[model samples]
Target: MKILWFSNIKLTETQMSGSGTWISGMNDLLSTYYPDVQIANVTIAKVDTVREEIVRGRSQWVLPKKTTAGDMDLFVKIIDSYHPDIIQIWGTEFFWATIPFETICPNVPVILDMQGFYSSVLDVLYGDLTMQEIIRCFSIKEFLRPSSSLIALSRRLHKSVNREEEVIRKYKIISVQSNWVKGNVNLLNPKATIYETRIALRPQFFQAVKWNLNRMEPYTIFSTASMIEPTKGSFTLLKAFREVKRLLPQTKLLFAGSIQTGIRKSGYMRLMEQFIYLNGLSDSISFLGSLNTDDLIKAYLHSNVFVNPSYAESYSLILAESTYLGVPTVATYAGAMGELGSSKSLLYFSKYDYRACASKIISILTNRELAVKLSIQSITFSEKKHDPKTVAETQFSIYRSVLGQLNK
Candidate 1:
């Protein structure tokens, strides 16, 4: 079976842009586990013309992001050439990816994969920011960029949400990673078939040594974000961290992500800086600018607690990986994070409730017995959900069922 994938990231490199870290693993596992399946990935790049490459026996296509008359013609031509038995459009956030759905061979089965569904994400775009904070979070850079602030993002997300609804209604089958996404998709299209699926993790996570209390840095916390935007709930966590600081002065935070640069700096970042400065948290907080997988895993293994303060997430890959590494974590009860925990594995606090969030973080940091319990359970839950063999087989099964290959 030839499967064609439309995604935002190319799988040819270690650091391809976008959120599908599992694509490479999925491709490899499916190829190894089920030899009959042939897969090709198509992604959009800023290149002037279309390009193609072979990566480990799979075809990789890079098309121009801008759709010119010739570009659409060429895109259609490629689709005709591949003649895929299954067309999988990964992540609906990029509206351009779904452009060829009906235009291509309509008989072929199509599966929509949810990555932080814009429709549900639209509801929590501002995270915990109040109207006053929203106004305060606006900066000259945000004014210049216009789209960086929460206000502009809300408008853009509203448009994306409309597109998402259309896509959701048109597709009969979709694969979701979280129950939160399943519920929202049901609201949009009740008749649509939903498959609960888990994405594979990078090998580094599975191979790395599990969290050991002896190796952990006392009073140290670790967190991650692609970009520390307001919606990521950075400020919400900052507020809680301040309270934790009072109780535990030695507590330190290591944020692993790119720091906001000259143009990228927004009012929200400025607001966070002020929060840190005004609260005397500058000495306690450290930002470990963009790290590779090895370095990220090292940070996770060293920290006492991992925190996810996002206002929303369809499924947080960081949380998943950390939990698998046996890191005790405290997360906000926002987005699908609320669905990520049981009484045994993870701890949760309501969004924007800094006091409650602080309490949870403190509980884990101070209680060694509780921390070890969480660590053990976290691994148990995460390893089960992210088992590469299980994920690959489940995905192949979905494809088989779609193509009526189940009985055979």
Candidate 2:
């Protein structure tokens, strides 16, 4: 079988973001397990450069000439040349780009991976912003800037949010990472065929890491995100950390994610820095500034607990990774995080409640026996549910089922 995959981010740039890592990991799994299958991956390029290359053992990769309006023609020509059995578009942000596919590849089955619904995400991020602020934040030029990729992507996605029922009706199937996302998809396209496929941890995360329950860095709390966006609730985390510090004076909060510094500093970054200074947490809070997977694992290893203060998530990949690494976790009951922690392995608190969040973190940090129990439970759950082989097999079955329905 042949498959053509479309995503805004290149699989080669997997280390940069969450969706890229997911695409890269899934592609690797398919290549390793289903050797006979032919896969073509087409990604939007950052610059006005085109490349068609065959990696040593991976799929044929096609990067668009550019992300401009004129590049759509070149992208469609590449798709036609591949002659794929099915087309899988990774997210709804590419709805405009995929419109031509319906007429060009009429017989080919297309599957839309509902990574997350843009409307739901926007509701969380801009929930507090006024109409003027929303407009100012998402101008047309911002949507075209490659430097602001996430915002640009979100802007495009927002355009299609109301039209999802009409747009998704064209696809043969929809794949979602979690039941929470499936719920959102159902609301958008009730008739759409939805498949729930949980993402697996990368092989690196599955490796055995020693869980030092007895000897951990004193009162160290760790958290990570791809970027310090408003949706990530970094401010909420800071507030919660302050409460935790009040209780335990020696506690330190370590953040591992990208932060724009210097002149290019974002307004949010400035606000965070001001908050830290105002709260007199300069010494207790530390920003690691975007660690790679290996370093992230090390952060999880040294920390006493992991905290997820995000306002929403389709699936908390970092939470799963931290749990697998054997850190007792405390998270807000937002989006699919509750589902991920359904095994009751981690402590849960109401979203945006700083005191409650701090209380939960304190419980985990102060109680060694409770922390050890939660850590063991989390590790066992991650190993069983996030096994790479099991995930690959399940996804392969879903692909086969989609193909079978298309044949019928």
Candidate 3:
């Protein structure tokens, strides 16, 4: 089967975010796990003629118009030429809105895989009259016209988009994923199918030599993720660590991942600078900038614990990756993180409670036996469920199921 994947995130080396990372993994999965299946990834890149071509091809705006056009045209051209069995739309806003669905092979099924449908709902719910009208254009017809199936990464996202009666009727399958498996599907007029998909660990990640257990040093609490402003709760993590440092001066905190540009610089970095200066934690805290897949694995291997204090998320890839690597996790109850399984293996606090989050970190830090137990469970959970092999097979099943429905 030939699959065409569309996303706005840059799939190249320069891009750094969850969506980009996922896109990269999708390509790898298609190439390695399902070699028989042909996959073409179409990402938006800006370069003049390609932008115009994409605009003409009905591509929707995902990012700023500078470097995303080439990727858009590539998608349209590939669809016209290869006529793939599946056209999968991953992420939102990036796929050009103007791309005429009817022109891209009438019957080819379009699968909308969403991490957050709330963006659309929020836009409609809170936007001005013009914004509401623009969204309405996509609401009743254009958006629904192309998709045969809709895939939401979480139930919250499903709820966000599934409210519209017209949307409910137009799509055939709607699914949401927990860490383990797909949930039930509702196939009414605005038919719905709920499926579960985990953020599976890639094979390349496992290839890294396991950390030398014997060489384990003082536990370092760490977190690595996109540096988005809202919901990431980097500030909470830092403040919590500050509290942790107050109790245990020897403990170290490391912040990894890139600084997101446009979103206000309210993430961990700025918070770290302030917290360190005000409380004098410069020596205790460290910032490890963006890391590639390999470096990330190394960070996970070396760290004693991982903390993600995001205010909201569909599911934190960082939390999943940390758990998979067997590092004890410290996270807030945001997104589908609680669904990560086994509270015993993780230390979670309320979404905005930094003091409680810090206390939990301190709990594990001071107790060696408990930390060891948590680490073992974290590793076990990650490998057993989230290994790339399992994810590939499961996704293949979903793809096949959608294809079967399309064929019928």
Candidates' lDDT values, in order? 0.81, 0.73, 0.60
TM-score of each: 0.94, 0.88, 0.75
Write the number of the candidate with greater lDDT, choosing between 1 and 3: 1
RMSD of 3: 9.7
Minimum summed lDDT over a 10-residue window in model 1 is located at 11-20
Question: Which digits, one per residue and each the tens of the lDDT, describe model 2 over residues 1-408?
Answer: 888887765655344444457667777677777877777777666445677766535455545444543455765777778888888888776643346666666788888887766676766764333455345544333445445534554676567676665666566588998888888777767888888776866666766575687667969999884233567777677888899998899999998887775555554455567679999999998889867777777888889999988888888788878877778999878888887764458888877777888888899889999889888888788778777877888778878998899888
The ten-residue window of minimal lDDT in model 3 covers 145-154
Superposition error at 143 for model 2 (Å)? 18
Over 4 Å off in model 3, which ranges?
Answer: 9-19, 51-76, 96-103, 117-171, 179-190, 210-213, 225-228, 260-272
Off by over 4 Å in 2: 13-19, 68-73, 95-97, 126-160, 163-166, 208-210, 225-227
- Sorted on TM-score, best first, the list reads 1, 2, 3
Badly placed stretches (over 4 Å) of model 1 are: 15-18, 68-71, 225-227, 405-408
- In candidate 3, position 403 carries an lDDT of 88
Top TM-score prediction, candidate number: 1
